[model samples]
Target: MSTESPSITGPLHDLTVIDLTQMLAGPYCTMTLADLGADVIKVEPPAGDLTRHMGPHREGDSPEALGGYFQSVNRNKRSVVLDLKTAAGRTALLRLAATADVLVENFSVGVMDRLGLSYETLSAVNPALVYGCVRGFGDPRTGGSPYADWPAFDITAQAMGGLVAITGPGPGRPLKTGPGIGDIFPAALCAVGILAAVHEARRSGRGQFVEVAMYDAVLSLCERIVYQHSYTGAVPQPQGNTHPLLCPFGLFPTKDGLLALAAPSDRHWREFCALIGRPELGHDERYATNTGRVAHADAVRDVVTRWLSSRTTADALAVLGGRVPCGPVNDAAAIFADPHVRERGMLSEVEQPGSPAPVVIAGQPIKLSRTPSAVRHRAPLLDEHRDEILSASSAAGDPRHNTSQGQVQ
Candidate 1:
């Protein structure tokens, strides 16, 4: 590690991860680990991770400067460039892996095998190394998928995993989610698997390969539809903002904007009715219970809509903020201006290269009392820590040549 780099402090500070991942899914997973104080060494190719070339760069930043897409998830980690196609590069990676607690990658199914850096090979060099990977379909070691050889991205996974099937304003008009849940959800699961494998490795003095398929992760995320379809013997369809089972449990238009209100329970329903000046509706047999309210969803929606039509989102929130399960449908501007975001430190500022003003990105959500996660510094420049990493690896000495397997000095 470079002395100029900020010191990492968290629950995972002792762990060293060799990251051979590029783009979103893999980078996101490693970023999570890095945030938790893992010494993550991102081993990029000579040209660098493709995301570095992506646009939306800071003002006055040069062509070589990393863009927001890369910076957003690559922070709190060091970078080292290597030509993995060459024998020397492969040898260097093996040296790093010898000292690593974990090795993570997201290349296609056969990429690692082709590069001769498969989990089997690395684990032999360091038996206690927890190898983790994220794939579009899945790795053969986990379970063979028919589409294993097919190229995939966020949209493909979302569509195949059934997320797109049950999302949108109406049936037959499916829409992809605004964010890359297909990639992000898998990354989260992969991170969990890595931590679990690491824990077991410490206890058993052996490591295991942890894999997460993007398709599988997204399918798990859309669990509700699976159960719904199975139970009803009918395929689930898009129900717009409203849930099929819950009445008055979705977005409603207000004078100035939209508000997401959920008052399905009898207690909440009664209070909501009273707040909306429709107290009699609370006692009405047709609208009393959640079941009955679901039966009369249109009526319930009409009542809520009618009341909200005359009030701005702020005015509506004033009456139902804490009393009812209600919140304004916030956009980026509203979120930025929100007191909750400010107080919780949900947005983090980091210094940008060639820019005086710092750029803000989403902060770590996992809060721990003793070892809270943090962004210690900005993303590293390409090959920024190459010399330091190589020197450190050399000083540590290759564990591959040692008598004991997977022992970290």
Candidate 2:
């Protein structure tokens, strides 16, 4: 085990989280808690979290070195290896749960129950323990879905949740987003659910099951299309880079690169027209109101496109940066180079196991005045904190020994 102690300190410093999750969704949720200063104990199987084998590893890193995927979401966490299939492993977890404030997992519906570590079983030993689960459809505890037992990933969640239905250039051409919003958005919602459960437990001295289905979370994200369809009686399709209602509110190509410009409101539209050397269009009745602009979207786009095509991205921004709601479509390199990113402290560096130099990952975005969040340490090596964890639990005297036969209510 490593000798260095995590320096994380925040509002959640008193909370302890038992993280029994592997891939993106569950791990990402716990990572958010860990960043906020929860003492997250990542319980992995003997072979370790599968993401440890995932890649984009650093140069000169040994085979055992953690990959970018694992490092990104598992930092500031202590790792403990447990073979949950065995009796001893199950007993060890029960002991940990006895003292933990929260336990979160992302296994399929019945995996925990089959292992005899269901929420009912754990709550028997610790009544105030909050149990959170993230699944494809959701547990039977929530409303049952036909796809409850089905396995799902980010792509599947995106497609089923209505994101893909309204994404892309046209009706027949749908595309998944570049980032894994299906997994990430659910993880964020799960984190919120867990925190809410934790708060209620603290107040009521009882904990409840909290769940976030990937399908449901993504559906909530695409809430716009739902109301749009309900109110308009039209199935929204991929309208390309432009919005269906708001004209001049999408990606437009500049001489060098693409920039997003939105001057949909009449006031901003007037300002935009003045800046683009076409003040006459601002007064044109066909383009005056937003509704009129939408009715003439093709003409509006043509006028804006012609003006933007002659200017570079920098030149366009120089003229319309703060005056209009416009910004260059920044790529990764542009994001890295942006002064705002540096000023906001949106990147952090942590020590790499097999390399002499440190690696950079995203920093915590949530800010606090008194108890700020931070990335205090790198992700743990596999099973790196076993000795300390066992010793501490032993010293505290197993809470299971004090409970009544660990019976579920």
As for candidate 1, its clashing pairs are: none
Encode model 1's per-residue lDDT on 208-295: one tens digit a residue: 9999999999999999988988899889988799988888799999998899999989999999999988899999999999999999
Candidate 1's displacement at residue 311, Å, is 0.5
Best by TM-score: 1
The lDDT of model 2 is 0.89
How much RMSD separates candidate 1 from the native structure? 2.6
Candidate 2: tens digits of C-alpha lDDT, residues 250-307? 9999898898999899999999999989999999999999999999999999999999
- The 0-to-1 C-alpha lDDT of every candidate, in the order given, reads 0.89, 0.89
Alpha-carbon runs more than 4 Å astray in model 2:
1-8, 403-409
Relative to the true structure, candidate 2 reaches a TM of: 0.95
Give the worst 10-residue stretch by lDDT in candidate 1: 1-10
- Which residue pairs collide, candidate 2? none
